[model samples]
Target: MTIEQAIDSVKKGCKAKFDSTVELHINTNLDVSKPEQTIRVSVVLPKGTGKKVRVGVFASKNVETAAANLSESDIAKISKGELDPKKEFDVIIAEPRFMPKLAAAARVLGPAGLMPSPKSGTVTEDVEKAVEQVKKGKIEIRTEPNAPLIHTVIGKRSFSTADLAANFGEVMAAINQAKPSKAKPDWIKSVYISTTMSPSALVDIPDLA
Candidate 1:
């Protein structure tokens, strides 16, 4: 389909207001080794999203429970007054000061968009919610600088085209709103949207005026 057709079909079928203009940022392509494309979005269905991720919290208490039991691929431990946040675990629990330790893993996790925080309720007094959301179909996204390659899912293929299109639009909006403070030099460089087996079809967003 033509780019305009794809955009219009997505907009109309989704019942979205025109305020959120469709966008197709340009002039960005980077080697996979060091992807210049910074933005990524991945979507998943509500039911078939796979096993829930187990979040291991590193806070107080003296239990030598097998770290293996932690639902995520890794585990972290933060002391009562530490000031560092390592690569974010599926869940995090520690003295607020230890948040800095995450600097080391920020480049790795931040770009993957896995750095869970309080706003998302991952860094809260109650660690259970963090665990719960991870298990649910919580779509994760990471945006590339200058490029619009958001890694997100549109859920199972059983979903109707309209559902996928509307879901896609919602995620794009979220990424646009989540621009980092450090990205002032040039927020977006290019746009590429596609699904699991498809080629990276370049995006052509209109001025919308």
Candidate 2:
């Protein structure tokens, strides 16, 4: 199916009571065992993710605007298992100064995938900008640890077909741009679009710009 048709198909197949997320999955030709062949980057969708992101910040300097601002003491508590970050925020951003302090909590945060890292734009000096990006649909797209698959959400079932298609295009464009220099032209083996509980719809690979 074309991208638009697949988006519409998935949207119609959604039976969830809530607005189900429209997810994009891609099977690639990359060899994940090679560090250079992995895909790990954050992208801001043009049409947004159609879901609100709860952003938390950890910084030495006070950032009143963060959804859940954590101090050095709070970091200590999280490190010691006295705090459960999963319950507090959907995304976490940290200032460079607080990174060392955050290491103690990596055991708790790393496995959860909420530990801030410069690679994902979740660790920075501009905490407010990072928060804004996450709130505005910035998402991390990465291939599976041992597989050649990439999975991430594009938008929601409630979004218009055009909006979903646009977001999908942006994701494909980003993936293409991030292709490993030595990868084959046909690096993307297959792509699928689906809703939270809907059957996946195979999609024709859209032409890359």
What TM-score against the true fold does each predicted structure earn? 0.46, 0.94
What are the lDDT figures for the candidates, one per model?
0.43, 0.88
Instruction: Report clashes for each candidate as comma-separated counts.
Output: 33, 0
Best by lDDT: 2
In model 1, what lDDT does residue 209 have? 10
Cα deviation at 205, candidate 1, in Å, is 0.4
Where does candidate 1 stray beyond 4 Å? 1-54, 58-121, 144-149, 180-190, 207-209
Runs in model 2 lying further than 4 Å from the true structure = 206-209
Q: Model 2: what TM-score?
A: 0.94
